[model samples]
Structures are given as C-alpha cells and as structure tokens.
Target: MKGIHQSSMAVRSFVVMACVVIILAGIKTASPIVVPFVLSAFLAVICNPVITLMCRYKLPKWLAIILLMGFIVLMSLWLTSLVGSSINEFSKQMPVYRAQLVEQFAWILDKLQQFNIHISRQKVLEYFDPGMALSMTTNMLSGVGNVMANLFLIILTIVFMLLESNDLSKKAHLALDDPEMRLKQIDRFLQSVNQYMMIKTLVSIATAIIVGIGLSIIGVDYALLWAVIAFLFNYIPNIGSIIAAIPAVLLAFVQFGPAAAGVTAGLYLGTNMVMGNVIEPKFMGRGLGLSTLVVFLSLIFWGWLLGSVGMLLSVPLTMVVKIGLESSQSGMWLAILLADNVDDKLSDSSMENHKQDDTEQISEQEK
Candidate 1:
C-alpha cells in the first residue's frame, strides 16, 4: 500500500509539471495581455503589508492606496525616462555598436574559414541567433511593435493591482467556503511572496550599486545601463549574475580591450560571490532553500512562461506555488522543491531565550 501511494504521488507530480509546461507554452501566445496583470498581482502581494501599515496610522483607505499607487507611478515614470534617454544615446551610437559587433563576429568567421569549416557566418547566425541573446531584456527594442503596448499594459496592471488589493483578501475568503483553509493558504503564500520580494530587492540594489561603481571606475561605457541590467537579472538565482556580466565584459573589451574585460568579469564575479554566497544566505537563513537544479530549472521554466520578467520573478513564483501546495496535504512537494538537509533557522525570540539560558548556566558554573 505504501509503494502504491508513492506511485500515485509520482504520477501526480508528473501531471502537475506537465500542466505547467503546457501553460507556459500558451503564455508565449498570450503574454502581451497576461504579463502585466501577473506582474501587477505580484507587486500588490509584496506591497499589501505596507498598505496595511498605513491604515494603522489612521490614513483613509482610499488615501493610502492612492499614496502608494502614486509613488509607484512616479517611480515608473522616472525609470522609463532613464531607459528612454539611454536608448536614445544607444541609437545615436548604434552604427558604432553594429560595426564593432560585425568586427567581433568577423574574427570568429575568419578562424572558421581558416580551419576549412563548411559553416557560413549566415548559417551560424540562422542557427544560433544572437538577436534574442543580445537584446537581453526583450525583443521590444528590435523594431518590434509591442514595446508601447507592453509599457502601457504594465502601468495599467499596476494601477489595477493597487486598486484591487484591499478587496483581495475578502474575495479569497468568499471564494473558498472553508475560511480556515483559505486563510492558511493565503497567509503562507503571502509570507513566501513578501519574503522573496523583500530579500530579492535588497540583493538587487546591492548588486546594482556595486556593479555600477566598479564599472564607472573602470571607464566602461554606459555603466548605469549595465547596472540596471545587473539589478534586473539579480532576481534570477545562481546563473543570473553570470548572465548580467556578459554585456559589461563586452563593453569593457570594446573600450579597453582584454585586460579591462578581465577586471570587469572579476568585479562582477566577486560582487556576486560576496552577496549571493555570504550576505543573502545570512538574511535568507535557509528559507526557500531550493535545490541548485531546481533553481536553474525554475529559471528556464519561468523565463519561458513570462520572458525576462518571468526569469526575475521565477524563484518567488515557485516559492508561492510551493507554499500553496504545502499548505494543504502536499507538504512533501515543498520538501521536494527545497534543498535536502536545509536547516530551519530558529526564530529570533527562540534564539534570544537560548542565549539567556546559556548566560545563566555560565554564571552558575563560575559560582
């Protein structure tokens, strides 16, 4: 009977994974409309606590929401303006960028021809396209018509999220007749989402600042652009830091050749090692604790589902799903998603009590 139950569980797991794959496949078709709303919902989840705190200060509900929403809108506008100016500068210099790219690729093409390789450069371009990779963020800037729509959708979605957040909890309770179960799931989901967002944002900020300073010192072109890229990609676990290094390294090489490139790579690598390895772990304290393989796989899965934003949000999204699954009878699924032998950190209160006991014991021993 135990073996049969295990088999059933395995089947269920396979089915769930398969469904996720199918849903992601469909996202490519529906992403224009879907991405914004999904992004907004996640934003709202993370912001809900802040909104609630405002109410504690006796602010009117509508006023609090408006205040929060206004801040978001202004911030978004500023970000967009920065991006637009950077893009304009980039546009003016596209000829230089393009000429350099061709020069770089030509070196590879020359080496291939010297070896009597039958592969043409065009063939290589066709097979292993760089457009998607080169863009890094999205296909929007590549003369694609969707950039405006995407920007608009994201803004509208954020507004909707801010507006609907107050009613969200009540709606969830109403949706699920079992108030206790609904609340439990909602609580777990919110906790995981909030923790993920809070920690990830801090990590991103740290990476951006460090990378920006390093790049600016090294005289890399558009240091802020690279910093923005680093900040955005910092959301992706494990592999993202490496991916963010590429553009910087490229720019460094184009500007100051191989030595500068080496330093650029080293700086980014050192920043990631210190933060991802040392600092983030201290604050995270084994929460989430997703396996290395699961982290990479989730990156691919979510990236496919939602593009660059998906890759950024992948871990939190997975954490939310894992918490939701675990909140019911499927705690094992959460166990499966996380690292084996992950130590659950004791709460501060518990740790403080233990420290007090230790002090008392030490005093008695001295006596």
Candidate 2:
C-alpha cells in the first residue's frame, strides 16, 4: 500500500509538471495580448492606494479615479513630448556618433599594435561593432515607444480594472469554498506586490533624476533620453544598471574621450551603489524573498518569454508565483526552494501552525 501511494504521488507530480509546461507555452504564444494586460494590472495596483485614500476621505471613487487618471495623462503627455524630441535628435546624431566611435576603436587597435599586440582592427570591429551597440540602444528606445503607442488601450484597461477593484473581493468570496482563508491569502499577496511596486517605482524615479542631472552637468547630449533609459532599465534586476550605463558611457567616450567616459561610468557606479545597495535595501527590508539565482534566471526566462517588458516585470512575476506556491499546503516545498533563506524547518513549522489553527476552528464550530 505504501508503494502504491508513492507511485500515485509520482504520477500526480508528473501531471502537474506537464500542465505547467503547457500553460507556459500558451502564455508565450499569447504574449502580445498578455503583456499589455499584465502591465495594466500592475499600473492599476500602483494607482489603487491613492484612490483608496481619496475614498476614505469621503470623496467619491469615480471622482478620485478621474483625478488620478487626469494627472497621469498630463504627466504622460509632458514626458512623451520631451523624450520624443530627444529620441529624434539622437537618431539624427547616430551616424556622427558611429563614425567617432569607429575612429576611436581604430586608434585603440593602432595603440595595441604599438605594444606588439597585433590584433586585427577589422576582426575587433566585426566582433564589437560600435554601430551595433548604437542600433541596439535605438531599438530599446523604439520598443518602449511602441508600448507607449498603445497607451490609450493600456489606460482604458487600467481604468476598468480600478473600477472593478472593489468587486473583486466580493467575487472571490462567492467563488471560493473557503472564502475567509482564501481572501486573507489574496490580500497578503496583493499587499506584498503593492509595496514592492511602490518602493521600486520611487527608487527608479530617483535613480533616473540623478542620472539625468549628472549627465546634463557632464554635457552629455540626449541626457534626458539616457535618463529615461536608466529609469526603464532600473526595473530589471542585477544587470539593468550595467546595461543602461553602456550606451551612455560609450556616447561619453565618443563625445569627449576616455576621461569623460570614466566620469560617466563613475556617476552610474556611485548612484547604483548608494541607491541600489543602500537606500533601496533599507526601505525594502528583506526584499521579495527570492534567491539570487532565481532572480537572475527569472530575468532571463521572462525576458525570453515576453521580450523587454518581460524583463522589466520578471521579479514581480516570480514573486507572484512564489507567494502562490507558499499559500498551498502541497506546494510549500517548492516555495522554500525558491526562497532566499527559508528552510524545511520553517516550512514544517508553518504547516504545524496551520494545522493548530484548523483544530481550534473545529473546536469552536463544535461548541
């Protein structure tokens, strides 16, 4: 009987794994539709607190939503105007930057030859093409712009989501067998996500402002554009800041020289050190409880699945999966595996606590 039970459990696990693979494949195929809706849901989550605050103060929810949407629309228009022009100007100047970068590369190759290093300039350029980097930078901006082009649809979805927020709890209660327990779990998940999103957004904005100001002071052309890039990429974990800095540093090198590039790199290094390493952690506390390897792997996996937006949303998405797993009695082991520091003892303790709570509830019902 024990062997039969074990075999049945193995079959169940295999079935679950197969289902997960199928779901992931479906999501990948439907990413174009899925990405925007997911983005909208996150934005709505960010905006919900303000609407809640206004409603608490006796303001109508509709009025609060209108005010919030109006503010967002105005800010979006203002930023689009500035960033749009910067992107255009940068596009115009790309050829000039490309030429300068090529010359700089040739000069380095010649110096290498002077030191008895006979690296072929053509091979170096072929492998690490300046034009390729520049084009990639432009493509990154273009991808963001394309998303913005669908701003109307995204905003409309957000509005609908906000309007439906109050009804969600009601619907969940009606649908779930154990409404109270499930609602508590759902609330915990939402709260965790909301706090992370808010703190991360604030940090990203601060980072962007600092980068913009520093680059402008250093006389970098398209400082605003680079700032926007920094802001967007800051959402990506581990490698985002490094990727954001590359184009800016390269431009600094081409525009001025290695000295200016060094300064540019230093500015990024200092900002990330203070903000990412210091301030963010102070406020973020233990963070999303994800292991470092899990975070990095999620970045790559989600980026591959959903493209640029996926990379931006990877950590949050993983957190959702982790928290969901944690809420399940059978899935707590997987959650522990995904967690940064959690262990089997903690998982066992958690399960014991749940069992004790159930016993207490049963006694109350009997009484």
Candidate 3:
C-alpha cells in the first residue's frame, strides 16, 4: 500500500510538470498578444496609486484617470521627440564611430607592443570588437523602440484596467469558494507587487537623472540617450546597469579617448553602487529580495519567452510567481528556494501555524 501510494504521488507530480510545460508553450506561442497586455497591467499598477489619491481628494475617478493619461501622453511625446532624434543621429554616426574605434585599437596595440606586451591586434579586435558592441547596443535600444510602437494599445488597455480596479475584489469575492481567505491572499499579492514597482521605479528615475547629469558634465555625446537606457534597464536588476553602461563607455572611448571612458564607467559604477546597494536596500528591505541566481535565470527565461520587454519585466514577473507560490501551502517550499534568504525555522513555524489553524477549523466543524 505504501509503495502504491508513492507511485500515485509520482504520477501526480509528472502530470503537474507536463501541464506546466504545456502552459508555458502556449504562453510562448501567444507572446505577441500577451506582451502588450502584460505591459499594460504593469503600467496600470503603477498608475493606480495616483488615481486612488485623487479620488480620496473628492475628484471623480474619470477625471483622475484623464489627468493621469494626459500626463503620460505628454511625457511619451517628449521622450519620443528627444530620445528618438538622438537615436537617429547616433545611428547615422555609427560608421564614423567604428572607424575611430579601429584607430584607437591600433594605437593601443602599438603602445602595448612598445611595452613588450606582444598581444595580437587581430585577435584583440576579433574578440573585443568595438563595432560588435556598438551594433549590439543599437539593437537593444531598437528593440525597446519597437515596443513603443504599441504604445496606444498599451495605454488603452491600462485605461480599461484602472476602470475595473475597484471591482476586482468584488469579482474575486463572487468567484471564489472561500472569498475572505482568497481575497486576503490576493490583497497580499497586489500589495507586494505595488510596493516593489513603486520603489523600483523611483530608484530607476534617480539613477537616470544622476547618470544623465554626470555624462553631460563629462561632455559625452548622447548623454540623454544613455541616461534613458539606464532608466529602462535598471528594472532588470543584477546586470542591467552593466549593460546600460556599455554603449556610453564605448562612445566615450571612441570620442574622447580612454581617460574619458574610465570616468564614464566610474560614473555608472558609483551611481549603481549607491542606489542599488544603499538606497534600494534601505527602502526595499529584505523581504522582497530574490536570490542572485533566480534574478539571472529569470532574465534569460523571460527574455527568451517574451523578448526585450520580457527582460525588462523579468524581476517583477518572477516576484509575481514567487509571491503566488508563497501564498500556497503546498508551494511554500518552492518560494523558499527562490527567496534571497532561506529560513528553515520560519518555514517550519509557518507550517505549524497553518496546521494548527486547520486542526481548529476541523474540530469546530465536527462540534
């Protein structure tokens, strides 16, 4: 009987794994349709607080939404005008930059030879090609630009979502068997996501402003462009700052020589260190942290699943899954695995509490 029970559990696990794979496959197949909606949901969550605040002040919900949308539209237009023109100009200058980079490489090789370093110029160029880096940076920015083409659709969806936000809890109550308990879980999920996004967005904005000012002061070309990249990629966590710094540093090298490039790199490193290590942690606290491995894996997995936008949204998406898993009695083990700090004692205590609750409820029902 024990053997039979073990076999049944094994079959159940296999079935669950198969279902997950099937669902993931379907999501990947439908990513084009899904991506914008996901983006919209992200924006809606961010914008919800402002709407709530306005309504609290006795402003009509419709008016609040209109004002928020107007603000978003204006910002979008300004960004498009500024960053769009910069990208166009940068694309036009890529060949010139490539030429300058090649010359710089030759100069460095000659200096190295004088010092008896004897590094092969051909091998160096092949391995660390400036043109390849520049092209990669351009492609990444272009992918983001492509997503903006769907701005109208995303905004429209966000509008609808905000409208329905108030009724979501009511709908959950009607839909679930144990409405109060399920609603509490849902509320916890929303609260965690909202807090995470708000803190992250503020940090990103601060990083962008500092990066933009530093690059401008250093007289780097297209400082705003790199600053915008810094802002967008900051959402990614772990390696986002490094990726954002590459193009700017490379441009500094090609345009102003190695000294300026060092300064540019230092600027990014300092800003990220202060914001990421200091400010973010102080505000975010330990509860919201994901393991480093999980962060990197989510970047790859979501990027593959949904492309560039997925990479940007990867951490938050993973947070959603982690929170969902954490809420489930059966899935707590998986949540603990994803968490930055694994506390076995806390998990065991929580499990004991849950068991106690279940026992008391069962006894009450019997009585």
Global Cα RMSD, each model:
8.8, 2.9, 2.8
| Candidate 3 lDDT over residue span 1-367, tens digit each | 9999999999999999999999999999998788888888888989998899999999999999999999998888788788778877887887787677777788878888898988775676566655576567667666666777888888899999999998866664555454555436456557767888888899999999999999999998989988988998898768889988988998898888899999999999999999998998898776355898998999999989988889888888998788667666788778888878777536654776898799899999999
Task: Tell me the deviation in Å of residue 282 in model 1.
Answer: 1.8
Off by over 4 Å in 3: 115-131, 169-177, 182-185, 287-289, 344-366
What TM-scores do the predictions have?
A: 0.70, 0.88, 0.89
Tens-place lDDT per residue, model 1, 216-306, is 9999877887787788778877777887787678767655656898999999989999988898888877656567787788889877777
Candidate 2 per-residue C-alpha lDDT over 121-222 given as tens digits, one digit per residue, 9 for 90 to 100 = 567556555456656766666655667678888889999999999776566455544555544655656677788888889999999999999999999988
Error of 3 at 221 (Å): 0.4
C-alpha lDDT score of every prediction, in listed order = 0.70, 0.83, 0.83
Clashing pairs in 1: none
**lDDT of model 1 at position 230:** 86
TM-score attained by model 3: 0.89
Q: Flag clash pairs in model 3.
A: none
lDDT for 302 (candidate 2)? 90
* Residue-level error in angstroms, candidate 3, position 366: 9.4
TM-score of 2: 0.88
Pairs that clash in candidate 2: none
